[model samples]
Target chain A: MKTKALLFASAFVAVAASLPAMAQQTATSPTLDAIKARGFLQCGANGNVAGFGLPNAQGVWAGLDVDVCRAVAAAIFGDATKVRYTALTAQQRFTALQSGEVDLLVRNTTWTLSRDTSLGLEFTGVNFYDGQGFMVKKSLNVKSAKELNGATICVQPGTTTELNLADYFRANNIRFTPVVIEREEENVAAYLAGRCDAYTTDISGLASVRASRTPVPADHVILPEVISKEPLGPSVRHGDARWGDIVRWVHYAMLEAEESGITSANVDSLMTSTNPNTQRVLGVTGGMGAMLGLDNKWAYNIIKQVGNYAESFERNITPLGIERGVNNLWTKGGLMYSPPIR
Target chain B: MANANAAAMDAAGGIGESKLMAWVRANLFSSWANTALTLVVFYVVAKAVFFFGSWGIFNAVWIGTSAECRAAKGVGACWALFPEKWRFILFATYPFDEQWRPALSSAIFIGLYFFSAMRANWNLRLPIAWIAGLGTISVLMWGGVLGLSFVPQERWGGLVLTLILSTFGLALAFPLAILLALGRRSHMPVIKSMCVVYIELIRGVPLISLLFMASVMFPLFLPEGVSIDKLLRAQIAIIMFAGAYLAEVVRGGLQALPKGQYEAADALGLSYWQATMMIVLPQALRLVIPPMVNTFIGLFKDTSLVLIIGLLDILNAAKVAVADPQWRGFGPEAYFGVSLIYFVFCFAMSKYSQRIEVELNRNKHR
Candidate 1:
């Protein structure tokens, strides 16, 4: 009887030890499965950033970051509207994604080495190549960021921008007073109320804050200098390589579509063209979509429904009078480049 | 003739004054000191009213874009933004086409609230009415049946989400609080200690911490692949937090009850449950009506804290509204609009609670 019980216990331990490996093989990417089962993509977004993810007067979310989520949804479900946005603050965005509260976080979160390694998150790619910049009143006559020596600058605490500010000032051998605030709005309000001579944040943030929060847009000027690299992107939990691949390729596909001039308006005409590259991207020639465990027409659906990277940029970012300087395609001498679909 | 003339003069200037003059005297200028103070206050108040009225009403830009608002700068409030963005502020990210569902649900909730406030509705039918009302609201908001389009709980926002969190939180908390109150007073040492620990632990933390735990930490404790909706998690946190405070209020009521009531029920051969339900709870609950309503009001306002965890309550929706590039820099107007809505709801609750308190205490001797 003792030998029989010991044999049963040994069998149980053997099965239990191999259970995780079997589970991993069966459900390769639970995030993708949950998303498909739910019939919509749960996207975390910045609720307050104007040109990034704020909602419109009609209660529809429209912005560059929002477009990335929409493109992902279009790629997965072939419907851009098949997405629910959870507006998360900077403090809550990571935990929301990590806890599976949101499938993808496309908030204007700066991708840093620490976040990538320690936060159990994988940043797909830089959707918006942002950089830290300074904004000051036009009346201040500070044409260059270097001119603001001994000035009181309002900045949000616990952000990469704060670190960048200190580094830039020390490098230039300039002295300045730091007026640290907790919230983005408070920093802007402090700047507008003349409590600070300048406000430092991402250039896109400066444009949005000036365009949306300033009483007069012409009153504020974003400085010409780009101090620190802030590559904002979509992120998913680590270990979901399939989900990460889908998000990464969705961005790449958009950029490739832009470089190839295959816009949403002309995707149908281009789909039937004799061009092998277009055929491959439209899924008539290659199995790129299948490699990501998606349908052949996934990239095609993304362009057809949510448009390319340029279209999203023009639609959401251009209204703030922001020129797509470094965000332009590689063909136009910008850094935006995509791997060929074939 | 001289006396009559003196009376006529008095009526115009002194003792037997006209009604309007008497009112002015009583309210504004009874004495020289009062007259001087009233005049100074009136001057300051009138100047403020004039400036505000001119800016908000007379010289305000009523219909235009942000460019137009800027053109009218230093003149008045940008009233045009309100009409353009009121829906976003009120319904938030609810699908534009399906906004009517949230609108209808809010109406039903308000109707039920007012119905429940009336003393005449305080009976068995009240609970039945509440159940029916809440069920209809759930069907309307969730919308997986009755041929209505399905709306998930995450899409719910603005005033509708606020009312749901508060109403449902209070509804679930009330009974749990009653049980906790009884448990804390129970003869069983284990039950009493458990109840005491729960109350103290929850009450020791702020609502924001509880919400943060619900949003961030709670999922870590759950097994993998099992998840709760963000709104539901916040609602649960609200219920738990409210239950602790409500339990204390209920305990206050239970402690105030006379010992003879328990003895009387025992003499009548009543069981513990029966004695508590029939003889103890009704009287104790009535005694704590004011405090109980005060707790409900606090819970209603505290529901706004869910926005910290990304649930779009009315206040958060207001922030989103002004964040729009089209209506930017209209923070004051947007906040004022939201505060008005909150004031209306909270004011109604305050008045109702006051009325209930009076009604409950009307027959009391002291």
Candidate 2:
């Protein structure tokens, strides 16, 4: 009886020993399978920040980040309605992606080297070029980031914004007090309440915050200096290179569509034309989509379902009164550039 | 015929039957003062129920994705926001696919808690089971070894963090507290003074400052190259906070044990450890059970403070969900959802403690 029991015990131990290994093997990037099964992309974006991502009073998500979500949905399902948006804070964003809580993240998140190698994420593409800058009330008359040496700055916790602020101040040999708040709304309130002398975040965010103000937009001025190179873009988990390619090209196609003037309003007429660039981009004369495991004319569906890059921006970001400035196209000598469609 | 019936009832002394006025006289209208107080109580209760019903039920937005909750800005609750963003608020960045981790873990946690709360299992065997079960849970959640790809602690968040912090915190605190309590009562001057110093200082300060010290200062205490995980620091702070409170409660129990019980142990020729473990402790622990459970509830709510440390819990998760540009202007729904989750947990704990109190009282006679 004791010998029989020993045999059973050994067998049980062997099975239990391999369970974690089996779990890891099975857990390899379930996100792609899930998205294919659901036929819609689950996206993570910031909940609020005017020019980047924000929901309207009607509960419709808008802004550059929201557009990225829409563009992915349009690419996959040929309709933007298939998207499900999950909101995340800066600290929560990477974890969410690693956990597969979201298929892709386009919440104006900066792509950094440490995040690329250490965080287990693949950067799809940079959609917005932004940099960290400080914003102070015009009443302070602080002309530059270097001038405000001893001012108390309100910063959102759990963001590189805080660390960069610390670095800048130390480098400049300036001493400043920090009043940390988690939510942007709280930071805005505290700043308005005169709890801090300044606020620091992305320059575009400063413009967004300034526009979101109530009574009037007369109170704040964004400093002329830009700090860190914040190439904010979309990201996905590090697996399934096929899925990553699809997301990356969707971004490139948006910029390409804008340069080609193939917008939602004109996509049908353009699709009918024999123009080589349009035919190549719309996949009518080439096999671009098949390379990414998608159908031909995927680019056409994307632009048709969701507007071109410029159309999305004007409808969403332009209302925030942030001129394209550096976000303008390459033909106009700005940074918006996409490689040839062919 | 009526007159005859009235006469018969009067003769019977209202034993089997009574009129409306008679019932009023017997229960509430017995005296003028009693009737007046009864009217006031009825009025207050009716008004409260009426108002709450109108706001919570009659005008509630319980469907259609929170867009229909136009009254979200009103004084009463706007439940529509909760319905719309319930998943984001509850799960945060947890992969929608593996959300079952927190979900299943939540169920396993609650089930084990209920199992321990069972009267039959409230003993040494049960606490041992609890430790084993929680250890398994932690291993399952934070997989790094056994070929499982590790999920970093930085990504650990939402209700998962809250559960781990409170569960481990309570487990760690109870033992340290017991020792501290014993030390506080010891004859040795050095140990007694050390326990006193530890207890007084921790109890004197707010829990927030202690949390800050853990996250910000623990790194400073460690060697320059050795940086501790921020999540572990929060856990340590929780343990320290819970220990101070638990120690005081234990000290009260120790003080309450009758002198004769101590004398009897001494007469039995048992060593100090044996006597305390076998006899004195059993009685003292029974007396402190109810208060300790109350402390457990408090700690559970207090775990929400991890939000300040940048780890998302129920409260913080709700705020983030509402901040989603898609949900816009639905902060109230998020608040209502999170509040309900907290209420369910704290409410169940209180009820369990009450049940335990009653059972313990009944068994004490034996």
Candidate 3:
């Protein structure tokens, strides 16, 4: 029995050791090439998150993260519909990307240093800037997070949300008990049942829960303070720089289009714009797409098919009642900025 | 009534006592301790029945939108969720207009089971029927040949996918399981050790790990520009996992057979394969029917684990159904419906196993 156990352990270690080496075998854009050969992009997505990634009742995939994949698909195939979605749980998302099962993972995964550097993944660009916040009943009469000194909070375990809750409370020198639950639904139930005084998670999640989970949406108010930086984005395996570049540029193209007053409806007229930047981005005056080994009209395809960043955002996120706060373009005093297409 | 009572009393002299009172006296009020315990249990059960009855049936909203569901929240079950999302829960992302294909396919599966269940159909005809039934189901599901629109395997989900995974997994695993069981007991050391290693290695790991390897790792092992269908990979994993566990159950039955049976076959000068096929296997298989069916029921429910790998089985479909922002917070209604479906399938398997156990054990009972 002991020998058998040893054999299992060693076999596991050997497989684990060989996987990283295998993942590094290809240096060129093999993933992009394979996706082209396959005729459709395989997108790893979140199955249930409302504004980030989800399929509607008719099984149509829609959301901000979903749009990111569509944008990439549009850039490559010139057809945004040529993408197949694979719903991935949070735990399986990174490994699914690393193992080459998915061409791109736009699954509301937070961009963190450890995940980006150590996990052999590259975060292309932030699609949604999320931050941890708290939600409390309006009946509590608490105006701010600092007022809840002795309250018990319900949070999902093993998440940055729980860590942020602890850190934020300790930094304020306040005392609060935590009700750690494993699933989101249970945490929402505990909060609604008055088992805890507050529920803490990402601001978008708090908004989602308040809008949907609560019996009365107006009764729960999300706290004003955000405790952590969660820049959710699209990612690809690290070694495929060309594929990574394509994804990064696709996201940037959306932002740049939004910045350039380009909407999907107006993109055709803008194709004849006299401004050099607009001309270059619209593929009327530059060979930028050739540099990426794609058609000169790659950005044009993305903007035409998947829309600009704001269009995608308003269509997907605004329905969840999330405001375009820090996610707005830099010209509008937000962090969304794009490098020059020229 | 009075005349009849008088006539009965005249015909047979009897004490004036009610049958209900007599039963209560014998059962509930047999002794001091019994009467007290029965009253307590009855009170608790009655209260529970009242609570669930009001919550689930009486006050429940049968048909309405999410607004009505929200209005009845906490006070009653939102049964309206089923009316709204039943199609999504059962057929999942299969094209809405083309849902009748899956519906028909599921009916055919149940029909095939019904046909195969009869004792009279236990022959070559059974296998032939299964082949035809499954072929028709496949044609219906993936229909480009029959003037029906083509629905790819990726769009398949919900109860149909669950039935597909469990039924096909078990059907394919059963023969492989028997082979492994026989190989484990074979005199050839190489074959025996190989079978032992295969079973042990597979049985040692959790099904989730095997599924993870299939979903994530298998693609990496394939050469560049080549990929297998995710559903097929998960199906293979389930088959391998069920095969290992089923092999051990079969081995239990094989070991239980007496040495005298083998000796008797040997004295008859029959070859090993012939004796094993004609004499040993039938009895051994009969002895293991209960445990074998127990494993089948387990594997059937374990198909839900495919949800973790992103395949939408019925349970996952229910979850996705409730995940719609408009219908969020109605998980209990969706899950209750899902549980009923699972219970029906698993319960049928258990009852069928009991029936076969009794049928096969008739001679022993005599």
List candidate 1 stretches off by more than 4 Å: A1-30, A213-219, B1-44, B259-269
lDDT of 3 by residue, A1-342 (tens): 443343344335534544664455332366677888889999999987888777777767789999998988888889998888888887778766765678899999899899887676789989899999989999999999999999999999998788888899889999999999998989999999999999999999888788777878899999898889999999987655677888999999999999999999999998878999999998888788877767889999999998999999999988877889999999998999999998
Interface RMSD of each: 6.9, 13.1, 5.0
Q: Model 2 off-target regions past 4 Å?
A: A1-342, B1-48, B71-78, B122-128, B143-150, B220-225, B363-366
Q: Looking at model 1 chain B, report the run of 10 residues with the lowest lDDT sum.
A: B217-226
- Sliding window of 10 residues with minimal summed lDDT for model 2 chain B: B217-226
Chain B TM-score, model 2, reads: 0.84
Q: Which pairs of residues have clashing backbones in candidate 2?
A: A47-B323, A47-B324, A47-B325, A55-B325, A100-B95, A101-B94, A101-B95, A101-B96, B82-B333
What lDDT would each prediction earn against the true structure? Answer: 0.86, 0.75, 0.88
Best by DockQ: 1
Q: List the residue pairs that clash in candidate 3.
A: none
Per-model clash counts, in order, read 0, 9, 0
DockQ of each: 0.44, 0.05, 0.32
